[model samples]
Target chain A: MSEILYRILIQGGSYKVIFNGLLATLRISCFSLIIGTILGALICMLRMSRVKVFKFISSVYILILRGSPVLMLLMLMYYGIFARSSLEAETIAVITFSLNVAAHIAELLRASIDATDYGQVEAARTLGFSAWQAFRLVTLPQVIRIAKPVYQSTTINLIQWTSVVGYVSITDLTRVINNIASRTMQPMITIIIGMLIYLGLAYIIHGIFALSDYLQTRREEAA
Target chain B: MKKFLLVLAILLVTSSAFADDYVGFLSRLKTTPDEFFMMMKNSWSTGGWVILGGDHSSSKARFYDTLTQMQLALNSGEIDEMILPDFVADYLLKINYNYSRCCISSSGKMGLCFGFMKENAALRDKWNEALSSMLNDYSLIGLAYKYVKNIPEDESYDEIYGINRKQLNKEKRIKFEHFKDAPTVKVAVTGDLPPVDFIGEDGLPAGYSVAVLAEIGRRLHVNISIINVNAGARTAALVSGRADIVFWYEINKSLSVQPDVPDEVILSMPYLNWDKFFHVTLSDTE
Candidate 1:
């Protein structure tokens, strides 16, 4: 175990590169998550709207984004769409990943909103609450509670998908690990380290979500 | 149990008819498609695949991400035959002690030369003039021998491939000369090509090509900057101005396959050349 640890930490000063890669992965994942969630909320609102045109627009957007593979989307964004542009690969990765995540989040949010009891909105209206007021106070809070679990999962998936950013020339965790493994000719140990890093990141995200859920439940109990 | 053992023995004997014979090829999925890939593809379809195994199946052609993977596959029985440079095979067989190879053909003429943009004709001429001097002196052959000394010592070249090694003075020397005005040249090479260009222990590019280029730079009064790139990015490196020269083997075949490579890029005279491909295989013990 010590020898393995020594090799992992000491060989070729590769740990530094792997750490830098982890940071790049996190940066892309976080920025994409924020952008995706905001865009997803807007998409969810449009999808929930009574207007036929808005509903149609949201449906087409979801259909296209969800249909394509993330790898294909990333390639198109980097090599085809931005082939002539001066945009850096990391910027392109964020844009592509954000668009990808927004489609799934839109569906998740739409389902959560739909699953809310319609009678609650009716009750709010009987108490002289406006449609906007009813949605803001009664429906939105319940939607958050119902959607949080799925939203957490979607965020974790977004983080993992950032590994393929290497296709566009961004040195994310997985790509760097593969490069090191190729150079050292030790795929077994290098792969384990990569997996451990990803597992650690995933656990942190899970912990934060769990903590949020625990706090929310406590606040409800207090109420 | 006796009946099962008898059935197993029969099955093993029957499976021997389809003995594991895999020919490894570098795919564009990982590396760039060069003349080596094209030649292998053509040869496989024509008859080379049958020579190694019985028939070409979808499973017979194994794809490798890097030459190192191909080397490992050659050891692990994942692949039986691999298309590799003559020198690389010699070095591996010398060290591994469990691998053997047979010469396929030394008749294929391919030039390993430096490439430049069409507008850079003056630079190309200067480099070509320098290369000719080295080729005449046999110093380049000396350098190749320094890195790899395994020359085909048998009379098989003429008998099988109709090429006479002795008549051609297969060895050449490259002289090192200082230039009064050395221009800085950025050269691109795929670092995954072992014994030619590969990442060394210190995480920097090191190999036979690295040594050869360093010597060329010294002689030409040119400062050489090597940009290590993937096979896929080699052409792009030249087109995007990231590299001024590309040290590629067989420019005609490598560039012909890549449509994006512009007509403006020109190939220099052959400095390094390989005449044949060898059939690399594992010994029974391995």
Candidate 2:
């Protein structure tokens, strides 16, 4: 299978296209993960607020994002929102995916915050801690611990979902494979290469997640 | 009443005279020049008369001989209506010319004859009329037979000789000949060759294999059709009697060691030569 893929990639300038596409995909996924996580934390705080209007708005936001498919959302943002505009497709993909991931991440973060031991927050409050200070000291740390596994998986999933950027003509890994197959007239060879590359990238992501999990466990054991 | 009767007789005589002229023209041109030239003349005369009256053919033919004469004729402004067959009119009018002529031989094979003219509206209209008339007169079945019977089998030996000899002995050759006429000996090819084989435009088939097999069908007098199939299903296409030939396959050395092909199939000689290349670009730093 690798041999077939190797032949196709080498023939049609597909290898370079795939390499560049993979790099772009990684860049977008990583950027979105960071941005979405920060945004998610902020949204979670808004959700936890005492204000009724704030909670309702946050609920509506999450409902809209979670209710729609990523593909439909991407298209809406790209064409519907930016009609007759001259924004690049890659920019649209990044914006759309980051916003989409933020919605789910916000829900996960809110759950983790709610599940935290209420006694810890009360103890901090009893010791004359302000609301912000208590959140910084006790609540935030515990939420991170509970949410880390979910966050890690979301990042991995974001990486996979980035493959759909090819639909907007961003020349992602899948697009490169399609182009090669068309030029060489060999679908079997190009598709096999695309699958191997995807698997390899997934393995790298899993390794990084495993390392982070191990480090977190060690820190807990030390404490 | 007498004048009315005379007018009717005159109309009948004129109609018969025109028919006689057409028949005389066909007889004169049939034995003289190439078939294409004769067909062109016939098409021009018939199409011109049908569309516009007057001696357009003689004037058009004369105009073709000299550019100055054509210009003079244009400037003179004596001609009322310019008559042209579809193709020629299309060129004159600067319209998009998208017509293609496929020569199908008697054996049910197809071959491309000519194509790809730029926009020429006047010429296109003229050519269209001529083509329609020509199509009505010439039978596709007759053309297919003529194309196949003239295939120069002796010249094709260099391409197929070695493979055919290796695949079949004298007895097998005789058997193959018998099988060629077998009612069930249907040939099918996958209509999937990237850009060339399966083009997106007009949905018309264009490719080296399509061209070659169309000729073969004409030669064999068999009907041919293309089916789109994936790589894995290619062999199955043959075995299931859906296709008599698989057009695309790589020459892999591993086939000798771990042969995956079934025994019922026979591979044909390689018809195409391909070159492999690795393209490299210098780094930005350099």
Candidate 3:
């Protein structure tokens, strides 16, 4: 067992490759999550629009993005949509993952926003604020508060989904893990280490969410 | 009315232009075979599709679930041609034969060999000796024609090996060794590959490669256990000491593509040579 551990973690500097892969996964996930959040916020507004055309377009976008598998989406973006484009696979991966995350985030945010008390927006409106002001001051804050936990879960899912970027030849964590396992021919230890790293990432995300939740609660209490 | 007619003409022209673009793209495609199944070379310099690492090489193409899907992609005009080993292409063509849609383009031969750890040099030589014997005795050819050529049973054994059933069994039987310290060898095999290494219907690893390994083990007087693994895990199985040997093809090309692969592994003698590949496409006859 110690020998297996040594083979996985120490032998021939295999950990370096695995670490590089982790960085790739984190890079893709971070960029995709940031872009997706911004795009999703815009999409949420479009979904909530009074105009039928805007709502229809947003619904169709959500349906298409959310309906397909992320791996399929990544493949299409890499091989089909961006096939002739000079863009790198990393760029294509970010775009595909962001679009996919945006669709889900739009729905998640929409549900949270809708679940909030409409009377709060009405109260803000009655205070001589415009519709936009009411939504920003009263509705958006509550939406964020409601959606915070779900957002963390979605972020972790996006991180996991980024593993498939290897299809486009991006050496994300899973691919690197597989590569190490392949080279060492010691799949058990290599894979266990890989899984532990992923699990650690998940725990890190979970802790960050928990910390954010704690801060928000304390701030609300102080208020 | 003229404006409406002009808009309709423009739409028709635009759609047809899109179709033309699709056709043009198909004609220019250079497909590389995906490594999801049987292991082979990725870096043959004959306009074969090479799946490049994430270094963002200009030539890297798409990854398919399998070779058959890649063939389907080729037929449906999604890809122009697949650059796969002659052995794989032939195997695919035989099972999914439609001669009208495809044609074989013979490339130069690739040497197939078993990859071993540097420490297993003695074992490698022993296996090499066994392979040479099989090659000389025409047993290997018989095995190849049986699995690779898909020659009919009953006829292939006698016709290829020139030995009847009883003699063939006798030739395969292991002699008892009284030695207590003979090492048991563990060999890694991907049971997904047919005619080479595959899980038989009876749930045992059975194929030409397995039969060869068995014969080698019999002669060496060592117990050989076949460890089944996913195609991707073959190398890791070797490096991790989970399996001492793996049947590999075109080791030089594989190493060239994946330079990060440790220098510990070495190749045995080339057991088989595959030099022909076919381009499968939709027939223009329709």
Candidate 4:
């Protein structure tokens, strides 16, 4: 075991490479999440719209994204979109992941919107607010509140999903672990380390969400 | 109490008979033309499926043989489970194809075949006492070192003598003569092949190529860095001066421009060899 572990770790330099890879992974995932959230909000609005065509299009988009495996989507984006073009792999990964996440996020957001009491929107309408105004002033805020926990959980899933980017040649944490395992021929040790890092990231994200929830509740109490 | 016990024994026998009938159904299912055709179709759709397709009848027969053997082993509890080793399971399964045989071939003196077999929990436990001793005796590092040393170094006819061990050693160990004046020796490899260039869980670059490079770096006392470049971006990486060395290259006989890469791109001696062969046996049907 020690022999295998020795093969994985050198005195200094290798650790730096792994750290850099992790940073690249985090940067890509965060960028994807931000893009995904904005796109998802718009899609969610379309999904809830009175216009049948708009709702149908959004539903189909969601169905396709959810039905297909993320791995296949990543491949399609890399080969289909970027292979013939000038876009780099990292850029392709970001776009693909963002689109994939948007599909999931749109569904979550739509659900949250539906979960809001119909009375709130009706009241806003009675007060002479437009449909958009009702959503913004009365409905959207409650929906955001209700969806925060699910959104946070999805963010964690997105981070883990980012591991697949390595297939497209982006050196994420899992890719690093795979390299180490191959080098050392000590897959067991390398996999354990990778699992721990992922779990650690998940825990940190969960803690942040919890803290945000606590603060929101505290503010409500103060009011 | 005696009557209840007899009734329970009868029920157990009836269930066992039903199980045998179910196994017969599965055995028949394994040989159906439609089922075999579907499996082939699935394999074609998936990239790596090894198509044993010749005659449909023969393919079905082969399938039945494998499935029946597997089922018998399962029912008898001879081998409790079928377990694929990580590398084979992960890499091989990703490609849609049919496998001719489940066991790794032993022709190349590769150690992985045995390692994969040993991954079977029942086999590992059954032979644990003997296998443990054997494993302790087997030094994989020593074997790898021996294998690495045996690769022949290339020499030009212009050389005073064909490159010998002494010259090879000097060439490997010698510092780049232009290193002091030249730009840093940066290397790039595809980041997708983990255990080649990517960093590992230990927070280090631990792939086979990386490990070799790290050794080379230590011996030469040069500051070397491995840049993670995507497969499609390798040419761009070289042209942009982002990397001085491409970590991998394969020789293709059919491609004319294969060897037309940079003159500075020194090809390493091939460290591994692979060969494909078919085992033929005369059969009455043929």
lDDT of 2 by residue, A18-119 (tens): 687688788778888888888877787788889999899888989999888887787566546753456766777888888889899999998998899889
> Which rank order by TM-score, best down to worst?
1, 4, 3, 2
Give stretches of model 1 more than 4 Å off: A1-9, B1-20, B28-59, B68-77, B86-191, B195-272, B275-286
Candidate 1, clashing residue pairs?
A: B137-B173, B138-B172, B138-B173, B139-B172, B139-B173, B139-B174, B140-B173, B140-B174, B182-B221
Scoring model 2 with DockQ, what do you get? 0.01
Q: What are the clash counts of all predictions, listed in order?
A: 9, 44, 9, 16
Docking class of 2: incorrect
Cα lDDT of model 2 by residue, B107-186, tens digit:
11112221112332343243334334434565333433232222222223637644442332221111012224523223
Off by over 4 Å in 4: A1-10, A130-133, B1-147, B150-271, B274-286
Off by over 4 Å in 3: B1-286
How much of the real interface does each model capture, measured as fnat? 0.08, 0.03, 0.00, 0.19
Pairs that collide in candidate 3 are A182-B236, A184-B239, A184-B240, A185-B236, A185-B237, A185-B239, A185-B240, A186-B240, B32-B49
Q: RMSD, each candidate, Å?
A: 9.4, 26.9, 17.6, 16.2
Best of the candidates, TM-score: 1
| Quality of model 3 by C-alpha lDDT | 0.64
lDDT of each: 0.69, 0.49, 0.64, 0.54
Best by lDDT: 1
Write the residue-wise lDDT of candidate 3 on B1-286 in tens digits: 9999999999989876564211111111122323311123333355333443222222234454333344455556565455555555454444333322243433234466777989889988988888888889987787676655652233234668665645543443333333367788878765434445544322345566776677677667788866654444556557656578876534333323432234677777877666554444444523
Q: Can you write out model 1's per-residue Cα lDDT over A1-223, one digit (the tens) per residue?
A: 5544554455556567677779999999999999999999999889988999999999999999999999779877775777677787789899999999999999999999889999999999999999999999999999999999999899889988887776565667876666655544445566778898899998999999999989988999999
Q: Per-residue error at B30 for model 3, in Å? A: 19
lDDT of 1 at B100: 72
Residue B225 displacement in candidate 2 (angstroms):
38
How far residue A158's Cα lies from its native spot in candidate 3, in Å, is 0.6
